[model samples]
Target chain A: MKAFTTHFKNSSMTTTADFTNTSSITLKLEQVSKQFGNLTVLENLNLVIEPGTFVAIVGKSGCGKSTLLRLISGLDQPDQGTVFYDGKIHRKLNGHARVMFQEARLLPWLNVVDNVQLGLGKTGKGKALEALNHVGLESRAKDWPSVLSGGQRQRVALARALVHEPRLLLLDEPMGALDALTRIEMQQLVERIWLETGFTAILVTHDISEAVMLADRVILLDGGKIDLDVKVDLPRPRQRDNPNLIKLQEDILRRVLTIPA
Target chain B: MSINWSKLTGRITGWVLPIFLMMIWEIASENGWLFSKILPSPREIVQAAIDLSISGELAKNIVASSERAGWGLLIGGSIGFFLGLVNGLSRTADRFLDTTVQMIRNVPHLALIPLVIIWFGIGEEGKVFLVTLGVFFPIYANTYHGIKTADPQLLEMGRVYGLNHWQLFSQIIFPGALPSILVGLRYSLGLMWLTLIVAETIATTSGIGQMAMNAREFMQTDVVVLAILIYALLGKLADMGVHFLEVRLLQWHSGFRQ
Candidate 1:
């Protein structure tokens, strides 16, 4: 993890994006409410995400975390709300945002490089290889997704999301399905990449520690609203065995589990 | 030269049973214990095959049959694939078109031979029509099945990745549907031969079916048997061809690997 941090620290040569200015793309969801045939999934929720900030939304199943992601990505419409990207109001998908799903969801027919290039459009060959290299999957560029391990497939998914350099990157429990060790490694990988590119990153996960690990701010969702928002003021590459981190993680977990259905 | 005993044994396994059956048939024919009228012996059939080939009659019928099947398959397969694409992509198309297709598909295509003869009048058109009808249903049904059953998760991924409509169809939907489409193709090929034989019942002067029907009129059981063997060979060859194609195209999918 520390090694990747150093690598990302020197990643000025990797990206051409102008990340010098702190003022960049921001996500604003105002009075968001969503329902499906009389079942309220989200109700009057409001949130603001500044650029270059990492935020994780932790919740139990059916807590509307995935619904929030769908609304943010323009996959689902809010019943009574508005979502603004940068300064523009979000209506239809404008190709400026990308999402990483829990299942990797790599097209089984496409090879690793082709899958990465999918979001980049037709002439995305060179950049796709670069993105694959970022995820440490350059060796498997020509291999099919069916032959890859579960972790590798998600890495490819991450690479695909990052290849196009989206202003906003939405991760819908991307690491939830991975094994313990692989999940830790992916968290580190995502951290390094996010630290490097500084894209607005939003992660929706069930794991409390995962929220504390990568997210600058952890929001605990209970019912249809944000019940708790805690900032991780600790420095990057915080030790896994740190006492303060464990306390914060435990506190968040307690809050999440104790919330009444 | 060193002998590859295992390889040789493996290669010979497939041919041994057919060769054994042929030998038994030859022996029965030689003993004069077999019926000479209804089922001509294997040796007599072979003689008839050679005679037909020498006179170029076998080649002519083979060409005629090939033309009918080839044209029908091309037309029917293309139309079915198109309809499948439209219906698979649009719910409105499915509502408008699929119900009608489902209704028509339940009817046995061969039962319509009399109607086709009336409409097309014993010409090449009637035979082609039969083969086309036979080929249509499988391709349409399988293509629809393939498209409808495409992984919804993959479709979601495609949407998130900002793929346009055409890109989504080509990159996601088409490859996902290809395996089922190939299965439909194999079934349709079998039906093509079956339908052509049925179409030949109209007493047309050409094609393998007509040749067999013509031979039956003269008690030339050998020639009749030869034509049947030709149909069998043609069906087997078509199947092998499709199997080869599946291997070539779907080497990535483990289900199609062997």
Candidate 2:
């Protein structure tokens, strides 16, 4: 944990600003509103996430949190306004973005390595194994997805999403289907990757405690708008018992559950 | 090792009845309970098989029938598979072609025998044409069903991962539809033999059907029975071939896992 903190600090301190095609990525939404027929899912929502930031969006079931991730991932376009990736208008699926679903969405016919390689495109034979190694799944590279436990498949999916080193990684309740222990393990895995690569990460989740533990910024959405956007001022390697973390969780939970007050 | 006694007994029970029936027929023939010219005894059929096989008559008829069925299946199955893919993948293709194919499917292909005879008479073409028509529907229907029913979620995953059109088709859509397509292939093989037999019996001068008819005219009941046994063997062989293919190609399927 200390090593991770030290590494992130060092990378940020370097500040090698390159305007011509660099690694740092920024995602911005400008007055984006999406509606399905008569139903308004998101309305005039605007937010910006800086390079190498980990932000978590939490909301109730109908709060359009998933819809927000879809818009950012470029799977769907906002009906009202534009989303920008590094100042370019996000229209189709952005090449730099990748989204991970709650369900692993691993292709059943392809084995573990092939599924990872699917993300890598043509020049991916070696990088696929390397990606599997990143998620500690190099040993299960040859196994079919059907044989793996749910948690293992999710790990494989994380490998697939990361293999390409996507500039923007959008996660939609990736740990929702997992058991408590597996969810913690997956959270650690995700945090480790984010710390190491420092890609702009946005996680959409309903789990409030998860939002507190992993995210640098936790944005709570009420209906179609941002209700609370709080920055975590706690120390690195946050524990459940940490009073600061607990207090923050309580504060967010209160705002999330409040009914139009 | 202890034997699975119930399974072993069940297998034996299946073989016992057919063996017993053969024994009864042999006994009935020896006792003159069977008319010798009408239904030949098992011994006479086996003797006739040995004679025809050694004289190469059985081999020639068998080859001729198989060639016609094989060619017909090849041509019809290919066309059907291609059409199925087109109709399955493209809404435009389905709109233009699917209704016609579905309508034609309702007509029993065997009913076209008279018209087919006029179109391609007593030659090998008529028999092959009948087999092709008979085999076409099942293959087409199954391929269409297979491609149509390919899981949409998987296709979405393919798109999300940035697969190109050809890669998506080859890697996801084709394999997803393979099991259903194979089911169609298996069913079509059965239809192939059935149609060929009917066609050969109705029109042609060269196959096992002709051999059986010639034997009937001479009161060669033994040879006629021999042809029937050979037909049964050929059908079983075709089934075995298809079963082998299904196992080899679909080992990933849960049904074939164990």
Candidate 3:
């Protein structure tokens, strides 16, 4: 993590002002409700995230965790209430935020660097190269996305998102499709970057252990409402096998499994 | 050394059957086992080609045919591609134009040859018109399909990444649809040749098809055979051109990569 921070700092010094100023963001959702047809997905949900905080929303299928992330990102609007970003009501697509979807969603026609540059909007090949370096994928910068493994593709997606130096980074099960080992490596990479960059991150995941590993606070949703909000209160560079981490994971898992359909 | 030998044989493999068949035909025609009137020997066809080239007739006909094909493809392909872009990108345009395009596509273009002759006469215009009509639909249909079916997920990603409208279309939508559009192009290229062959056969003066018709009148079976061979060669050449284009444009596609 120390080596990664120093490397990122040295490389990022040459990038533009937009890439340098990684000012974090705060989010507040008040009485937010969303519905598709007759089915209410999120019902008057209320939450607040501090700047530079890593929060994970964990729930079963259709519990509306993903919907909440979408609302925060302003990809979808709440039917009842407003989502405030840094205390201002943001009702449209959040321009200051970027999402990393479950699928890498990298354009197959573009190579690694070009895909990252998509976040920078036609300029900033240098910034994009630095972002790829941050993800340890600078060597594959000229290679097509199709040639990369699933984990590698996600890393490129990470680079694309990070190139923007977004105030808020929303990850919608971004590591769900990865294998166990790759998932761990990606989590480490994301953790290291988050610590270095200090961007607010809201991750939606089904994995309890992942939530315990990465998030400072884990928000559990049941029937479109927050059922539990647990804080890790743990140190950085968390060990997966730590007894406290294991206990927290088990506790979250039990709570998730015991929730009635 | 062994690997090189196998590679060499691999290169020769595709030509082996065609060459063997030509040799057999040559021997059979020489022995009078096959009637020369029905199918001339390969050597006779080659001699006819040589004679025509010497007289500058073959080159003239080839140039005429190529110009017709090129003009038709340029005009027809542009119109089809333009219409496809407008319709695919705009729901209003799609609703207004797609049904009419589909209706016209159903009418056999070759069946319009007589009508075309009456309208434009058996001149260059009529033949070019037929080729144009023949090549338009596949390209239009394929381009439309390609644009319409561009991955929605990628578009959403583009939007989230703050890509503007033009960037979304150019970077995400167009590239996504390209493989399908190329398929359409290949299909239309084949149609271009087929339509030209038919139109030229029915019409008045100049192309390779006309040369074949002239030879038939004079009982120069070798010249007629040569025309057919030229068409086959031209069609092969057109297919190779499209393949080359696919290789160049879709190098990022795993299917197109070596």
Best by lDDT: 3
Using DockQ as the yardstick, the better of models 1 and 2 is 1
Candidate 3: CAPRI quality band: medium
Relative to the real complex, the DockQ score for model 3 comes to 0.66
Ranking by DockQ: 1, 3, 2
Compared with the true structure, what per-residue lDDT tens digits does model 3 show for residues A47-82?
Answer: 988778788999999999999998998888889998
Sort the candidates on lDDT, descending order.
3, 1, 2
User: Which residue pairs collide, candidate 3?
Assistant: none
Candidate 1, RMSD to the unseen true structure: 5.0
* Residue lDDT tens for model 2, B146-254: 8898877777667777888898889888888888888888889889888877787776778898898888889999988888888899999988888887787776676
Model 3: lDDT equals: 0.89
Give candidate 3 misplaced runs (Cα > 4 Å): A1-22, A119-122
Q: What lDDT does the true structure give each of the candidates? A: 0.86, 0.85, 0.89
- DockQ by candidate, in order: 0.69, 0.48, 0.66
* Positional deviation of residue A60's Cα in model 1 after best superposition, in angstroms: 1.3
Candidate 2, residue A255: CA error in Å? Answer: 2.1
Candidate 1 segments whose C-alpha is farther than 4 A from its true place: A1-24, B1-8
Q: What is the overall TM-score of model 2 with all chains considered together? A: 0.91
Worst 10 residues of 2 chain B by lDDT: B249-258
